[model samples]
Target chain A: MKIEEKDVFKSYFKNLTLRERAVFEGGITLGALFHQFVGTPVSLKNREILERSIEESMKNQPCVEDISVEIVGNLKEDEYVSLEGKMLDVKLKVKVENTVAYLRLRYIKELNYPLMYVERIDEE
Target chain B: MKIEEKDVFKSYFKNLTLRERAVFEGGITLGALFHQFVGTPVSLKNREILERSIEESMKNQPCVEDISVEIVGNLKEDEYVSLEGKMLDVKLKVKVENTVAYLRLRYIKELNYPLMYVERIDEE
Candidate 1:
């Protein structure tokens, strides 16, 4: 993410109510993990390893109540890492403040960007 | 968008504060427009017409405070409409709750879908 992008997110997060902020933090965590895997392999197993690491990492973030990462990529080893062909699917189920944001992302092979789109942002 | 997806978004939108709700309405409008352009031409001028229509349509939405739509696609007329090889960019700037959300989207050529990503959600 660019500096400007981070700044904007920070600004928005600060405006949310404490509970809401906590919920949004889950989205941020998933986004950051996706960022770390820009050139990584796009296989199911590789995604699992990354998911484990991310879940472990989220333990320290107070706002994260729960998180689940599902990576879906079924490509051969060679094509999996190549930037020319293949998109890594990253799905996240995050819960905070009694709210859940179901985010789905396609890790850009060329840009390595992860856009945690809120396919479902819910309050319960 | 799927029926489930729309339901999820509707539930979330109902929970937002009125002002926040207004701002978010902008994203929805842009998303709907992006959906309408699927299988359509990817030319810059074609995008302009669609953008104009979207902006005008948004006026009827009471929650819409202000909105701007920018479409970015520079392909030949023939190559533009073909779904196989192009991404149509739809950028939206929405104002709400005394805040602004900068959303960027790429209309999926195959799926004809729009994922309005909040590149930046800010409070000013």
Candidate 2:
């Protein structure tokens, strides 16, 4: 069997230890990219880099990235956008209270790929 | 077994017929939401709603959403942000050329969920 990027990613998450998972969470929310060091204190430098990036990107607004993830976030609003630059409408929900939201990179269209037209639906 | 939201989402994509996928793709890019009509014409009203949503969301960058998926997008730049709003930095890569990027709703930190610390890596 061939090892693909998706497989490597799946394996990485599947293999995370409890403590490691916690650290990973911290890195994500904090936007700190850390290189795991067996068992020891975290490096401040990596944490700083992540922090800076998060701030910069947020300021830019509607920015793009090679890779991106949101560990924990609140939806400013209930909304969805079509793939094309056109057509954007907001979905109003009665529950305006703070709700835990997840950011998913769905593949709706593909210029070239085995998979196209992907979407991220609520993970049950 | 409990039929979870994830299962439903997964099944929906898994079951998309080739023709349906093509129509779905059109809906996404064109920002048209279409209700599948078995083997008949699409519902134009739904398409109109979708188109409206896409336009509105893009105008408000850094905005939150209940759900989001970018099927095909060009990362304006190479970058990664730490989960915390504090960090914001850009990773400049030599390869500025266009590359297919995937947006993943990595579960680095989940407020509540059976599966936490979910990260979307390339599907190999």
Candidate 3:
């Protein structure tokens, strides 16, 4: 049988090492990102660049490649418009060895740039 | 055979629900607290009070109480001596239902108070 990212994510905590999960407590508290607001028709060009950046960052994590892992992180948009811009959400999937991890996040705008803030990372 | 907290923490990520683990990534980054510096001979009385506070916070978390969870948050000291103060360390253990979780943290002096900053939370 073949395992997928969703499977790895299902036991999200179990798939990772003990050291990895222990750090999660702090991660849950610290890695919270709110929504973002940028100009109209946010450039897909910018989004693609950022998506690649996120993927690279995830791949750079320790032991990610150790167990035959595959990560797919996408930036999704939310429906909230005002004087600001738009709010983008995330859907991240990671398959490690025989486990899978799928999570979500948020994209917020800073003074002049966009930041992909991790909202929450868990399986549904 | 009886399972202990150590056993649960060994598979820290695997034992916890996906949703729980997902929130941990953000928690790891956001819940980081730096060590604090108060007056001389920091009162153990204050430490107990703070420890209780931390336990309450952990207990209040969702799904924690669902299982048999025993959380022990302690304030340990470091060998950092200066005109300032001492740094404290933590050893936390949580038993969620059947799974156990053990993690570490740091206690730093802020302004004039003590703040418990989660260092690296993982079973070692």
Best model per lDDT: 1
lDDT for position A62 in model 1: 32
**Residue-pair clash count for candidate 1:** 0
lDDT of 1 by residue, B18-107 (tens): 334433344445434543444554454466676676567655442344556665555565445532212545555656546665555555
Cα lDDT, model 1, residue A17:
51
Measured on C-alpha atoms, candidate 3 has an lDDT of 0.34
- Record all residue pairs in model 1 with backbone atoms less than 3 Å apart, i.e. clashing: none
True-vs-predicted CA distance for residue B9, candidate 2, Å? 8.7
CA shift of B40, model 2, Å: 47
lDDT of 1 by residue, A1-124 (tens): 4222344334434445533443344444543454344455455346567667756775444345456655555556544553211244555555544666555555443433333345566778
TM-score for candidate 1: 0.38
Docking class of 1: incorrect
**Model 3: DockQ score:** 0.18
Using DockQ as the measure, name the better of candidate 1 and candidate 3: 3
Put down candidate 3 lDDT per residue, A1-124, tens digits, no spaces. 2222333323434544543343353243222212111222333335555445435544433223211112223334653222121243444443333334444443232222222222333332
Per model, kept true contacts as a fraction are 0.00, 0.04, 0.43
**Collision count for each candidate, in order:** 0, 41, 41
List, residue by residue over B46-112, the lDDT tens digit for candidate 2. 3334334534542231111123422121213343221211111111111001221122232222222
Instruction: Rank the candidate models, highest lDDT first.
Output: 1, 3, 2
CAPRI quality band, candidate 2: incorrect
